[model samples]
Every structure is written in C-alpha cells, then in structure tokens.
Target: MRKTSVLIRSIFTETLELINISDVVSKSIRCDGSELIVCGRRYDLREIKHFVIVAAGKAATPMHDAVVAELERSPHVWMNVTALLISPTAPRHERANVTFFPGAHPTPNEVSREAAESTLSYLSKVDGHTFVMFLMSGGASSMLEAPIDPNISISETAEFYGALVASGLSITEMNVLRKHFSLVKGGRLAVAASRAAAQCTLIVSDVPSHSSDSVGSGPSLPDSSTVQDSISLFEGLQDRVLLPESVISFFNGPLLTETPKQTDKAFARSFHRVILSSTELAEAATRLAKASGFHVEVDSTCDEWECRDAVKYLLDRTEALARIHPRVCLISVGEVLVQVHGRSGKGGRNQHFVLSCAMELRQRHSHITVLSAGSDGIDGNSPAAGAIADWTTFERARLMGIDAQSCLDTFDSFLVFKELGDAIMTGPTGNNLRDIRILMSDHEEHAIYHEF
Candidate 1:
C-alpha cells in the first residue's frame, strides 16, 4: 500500500512540474529585437505603435508576468505597452505599466466589475497600429465579468455564478450560459478591440479538447453560443438549480442579448492558441506511469460525467485492463459532475469523488488505489487539493470510528480523508487544466482486511 501510494503521488507531482507556466510561455512566445512571435505567428513591432496586454483568470498573474517579461526583452516595448491584469487573488507583482486588480473566483465581487470596466475601457480605444494580447484561463468568467444590463448588481451576479457552480453542468454548458450573461465575454472583448491591428489570445484550457471557446468564456475569441442556448440550458437546470430570480428573468425576458457569431468582424483580426491543457497533463502522467513498468490506459471520453457514473465506468475499465497486464495504471483526464444540494458540507468534487471510490474499493478486496484531484491545487471549498483512497480505506475508517458512507452522503469527505491522512495537499498551483484521476491496480485477489 505504501509503495503504490508513493508511486502515484510522485507521478502526480512530476506531472505538475512538467506544466510550469514560465517554461510553457517561454516556449510558445518569443520576442526578437524588432518583432514578436506567438506560436509561430509573427508581428512586426515597427508597424505597431502600442501593445495592450489584458490578462485575466486564475492563472492571470503568471501569464501576465511571463508575457511582460518576454516583451521587456524587446527594444522599447514596455514604454509603448498598456496592460490590465485581473487575478483570482491579490496581485503577485506590481508593475508601473500594468494595472493590477484582484478579483474573486467561484463568485464575482465588486472588484471583478472594476477589473472588467478598466479592461474594456482600455480595449475600447485601440487603433489599427495597436496590437492586443489577451492571456485567458479558467476563473475569468467570474473573476473578470460585467453584466450586459446596468441593473445587475455584483451580489446578484455572484448569486447566479454560485448557482452555476452548484448546477453540476459541464464546463462547456456553464460557459455557454456565461457568454450570454456578460458584457465582456463571448467575443465582446474582441469587439471592443476590433480596431486594433491584430489580436492574439493565449489560453490555458480547463475544458475538453477543441472547447477553447469555453475557457474564460472566450472573451477574446468569437462565440457561437446564443441567447436561445442559454435559455435552454437554464430551463434544463431550473428544476433542481435555483438560480437568482433576476438572472432567470433576464435569461427568459426579451432584454437578453445574443453573443457574437463566427462571422463577427472581431474574429477577423484575432487568432488563439491553447498553450496548456489536460492533454499535456495526460501525456506527462502516462509517460511516468509507463516508465514505472505499468501498462497505462487513458480515457478522457467520460469527462463531464456524473461522479458516480464516471467512477463506476473507470473502475470497471481498470479491472478489465488489470486482467491482461501484471500491473495497470488507468488515467482519466477532465472533471466529473457533482451537483450541490442546498448548503452542503466542506468538500470539493475531487475529494467527494475519492470518497465515493472508497466504498467500492472496500468491497473489491483487491490492491486498487485511487487518486482524484484538481490540477489547480484546489478541490472545492476544502483546504486540500483532493484525496486518495484504497481498499484499506474503509477498514481503517471503521477502526477509527469514522463513517465513510455518512461522509460521502453529507459531502464531508474532506474530514474523513484528513483523519485518514489521505487528503492531497498542494496549496494553490496558480494553474488550471481541469482535473485528473489516477487509478493504480495490482490484480492480487487477497482477502479483505485480515492481512492488515
């Protein structure tokens, strides 16, 4: 048990190290003395009079710092640069050319509005000689947002976001709804800076592949979602998800606005690259596991599935794979769904997911271990990133007077994982690539708890 524990944790940590923000940025973007290149697309500095850098999301500060650091290498780029950075937390750096604003995540605050206003204002006045770059990532939908309507307050906006988080909808669905609700999202940012000579957006995706439009609600990219789509999504979730009254009325009312389409003029000047995502994460983890002598299988098709269904499906896959190999490592990328009920307990989706597996692991009587965690180093409202569970988890909880089923039912898995010393902790990683679930199985059909 201890050997498998160390192996999985080491693989997880090494996988994270492979996705360093500065390293990824340095490789994807470069600036020569007279020109800049992003993902092989070059822009001549001689034709541009200004550079506008607008960075927003959980990874905003790091992205801003990396880009600004790169720009500084070019001759006189800082003097002609204007940047507005909105971070999920307080600003990590203070620069004279960059206006830093701290915003809230999982919910928007008044500060988010301030940040959004300043960004739009800065973007609204760019001319053809100005080049704009947007650093977008997860959390931007809430961390950098403004309502299309003047009557919507920050608190009400926050209430709506809270409802969305609890709705258990896929990130794609939630972001589609966000596009219609905000002034800056859904290609509005691109529209604001449409007069600029060219615009480039670099994204660290936290959604499924080819869904970069969902990242930060695609503020700098063209949006295909419409008001009708949002209306339908809200209708589907309305029975169990109690959205704010104002939000519901706005979505249903005639005043709601439609998002930009593919043919929007703003997209003509814009191009985007997904700099980092779960694909990179999966590749790194798979390499490490394969090197460790385990036959690895990766399944990402179950993304956005309900927590129980995802767990069951993956466990069955793990067992089947273990049958043909001496050892098996089953890697699943992307996040699972967990619909919150009213005011639930103190666990996030990752920890809750691991606890659910504990119940099944208990009955399997095999040497199977599971680790489910967020790549951002946060799992819901809990202090830990996620949790680890194995077949011995249930036996240990019983010996410690802990009720595993109660913990899972009440959404209080954090407490049990903490007591069992199985919670995965990494603080805030400042990077978002969605979530990763690693299952390690050694097909030894030993007896249930008697060996311990």
Candidate 2:
C-alpha cells in the first residue's frame, strides 16, 4: 500500500509536469492557415491587407508565440502582421512584429493601463480588410482595466478588489462588477475588433465551465449580464465589501447603456469565439493514475463548487481521501476562495487551503501529502504560484518557531509554507487552468520516514 501511494504521488507529479508545459499545450490550440476556412467562405490570408494579434491573460505569452510561429511559417500568406501581447510579465522573446507589454495581475497597474491604451491605439488603425486575432485566458481582467473615469485610480480599485475577495463573491459576480468599471472588458474589445473584416478570438479557458464570455471578461464574447446584476452583487456584499467613490457614483448615476442587457444585439452580431483549452489537466492526471494502476476519477469540480464554502468543503474532501484505504490517489482541479476577515499576511487561496488542510491532517496521524497549485504559475500577489503540505508541516513549523494555528487564523499560509520550504515555484508558466490539487497518503506500517 505504501508503494502504491508513492507510485501515485510520482504519477500525479509527472502528470502536472507534462500537461503544464507550453509546447504540449500549444499543439492543442495552434491556428494553422488550413483551418481558416469559415462560413462557407475561404478567406485567403495572402489577400489580407493587414493582420493583427492581441494576446492577453496568463496564457498570453505561449499562445501568442504559438500563433506567431504559425503565421511566420505561412509564407504564402502575405500581409503586414503586428502582434500585441499583454501579460503579467513580458517573456524572453524578440520578434519584430510582436510587441510585449508587462502588466499586473489581480489588480491593474500603471503598466496595465498603458497596455490598454496601446491596444486601443492599435485598434484605431484597423480597417475592413484587417484580420484580428484575440488570444485570451484568465487574469486578463487585472492586466487591462479600462478606467471608466479618469478619477478612478488603481489604488482605489485595489481597495474594492480586496474587499470583494473577502466578500466570498463568485468570479462571475465579481466580473460583472468589474466590467462596469472597465473600458476594455465585457466584449468591448470585440466591439473594437468589429471594425476589422474578420475577427478570430481563441481562448485557453480558465473560467469554470469554459464560459467564453467570462474568460478574461469575454473581451470577444457579447456580454450577457446586466448593470442591475452588478448592483445586486455589490449591495449583497457581506457588509465587508468596500466600494470606491467613483464606482458608487457610476452605479448610482443615471447613465444610458450602463450594462449589457440579455437582449442586447451586440452579442450576436460580432466576433467568432473558439475555446481551445480547459480543465483537461485533470484528464491528464487521470491517465497517470491509470498508468500507476490506481482507479482515478476526474470530475469538473470547478463548476459545482460554490466560492463561499470552497475552503471548508475542500478540507473535507481531502480528509475523506486520506481515509480511503491509504492507497488511492485523489486529484482535483478548480479554484477556491479564502475569506479574509482582516488583513491577510500573504498567500493565495490555494496556499491557505493546503495549510488549513495540513492542520486537520496532522490530527489524523499525518500521512498525506497535499500539493495545491495555481496553473498560471502565480498565486494571489506572490511569485510562488502555490504550496505543498503534509503531516509533518506543523512539526517543521514548530522547529522554525512559527505558530501554525496563529498563521492559519490570520490567513498567512504563505508565511507558514515558506518557513517549511514547501512552496512550489514555477515562474510565468504562461498558462492558467485555475488550481490543481493532489492528495497522497500511505498506511503507517509500510510508510518510510525521510529525514529533513
């Protein structure tokens, strides 16, 4: 049984390593010129007068690289191609036709605002013969904020965002609120691209259920939510959510076309949406489980979970898996939330979940190893994307003179995980599939103790 657990852990780790690579994933979403035929009309790229590419979110770099490579290979296609890539950081690449912009995630920065302005500037030059490609993924929301009012600053946006995270609001609800505040989100980019003769929007979906519009605030998809929905979410915010003065004024003031109504004609008229990736990482892990001779179950838990109860529910799931014959490996992929009561010290939601899970696992004789990671190679505002925890996590903390319970109480999981050298570091993976968690354990009789 111990041997089986070890094998399962190895398989899970191997699966994560394989599926998270840019090269492998790029193959799944590459745009070959041959696949360009649409609507019974074969649009020849060689005839295109202009070509433009816009890449955004965590997967922006790799996805941009892949499409750029594809276009470069098609010498038969003749056009002046220019690419605009927006991500949390600019990757190490040099292409004459490509412009890389580094922005901030989870909140808009000065750089992000500049990037947004630059995209709009480029959009103004597009013509009817231009073909625009929009590559979108998660985190695009913060990478580009439209700044509905000149008085709305990033600091004020951060305060509202901080309050929203603590309010236990769903991403869908949060984005609805975010769209009203932004100039570039909620299909506005698509509206900009509508000026082009042909527009192709490809997505590496990180949103739950692969909702195209919700991913990166649907810069290409027509907005289905309304301003009323945004107001309701804001008002329902558990007395902890703070609103910026500008946001409050915008919501309260009488402005025409403040939100996207379900019946809005803009959604149906423009843009061609394509979803290229999703929670398939769980499927990759499942294959590894089969290779290791364990029965694996992969479910879209991201869709079923409620944000408010996510942490406690995940803890319960991990505990239940720990009791599962000490041989089976349980893997899950999805996003969860950590409700911040006060100032959170430092950590992402996954780190907080793993730490909280570790506390409970320690009471059960501490045999399990839990790895919780954000697929984007980032978690919260930290460089380390995620963290790992096990039975001995608390024991190690005692050695470091850190109070595990106190840190957990303060929601400082990053600090606790850091002291134990358990944080997982994968810088700028250029992909976002939310979170992946693996739970591994073994029986006491056959378990081997590794000295640190």
Strongest candidate by lDDT: 1
Deviation (Å) of 296 in candidate 1: 1.0
TM-score of each: 0.96, 0.86
lDDT score for candidate 2 against the true structure: 0.69
Candidate 2 residue pairs that clash: 146-183
Q: What residue runs in model 1 are displaced by over 4 Å at the alpha carbon?
A: 89-92, 443-452
Cα lDDT of model 1 by residue, 87-175, tens digit: 85545567678787875888999988998899899998999999999999998999898998768889999988888888898899999
Identify the leading candidate in terms of TM-score.
1
Worst 10 residues of 1 by lDDT: 443-452
How does candidate 1 score on lDDT?
0.87
For the record, the alpha-carbon RMSD of candidate 2 to the native fold, in angstroms, is 3.7
- Residue 180 error for model 2, in Å? 1.7
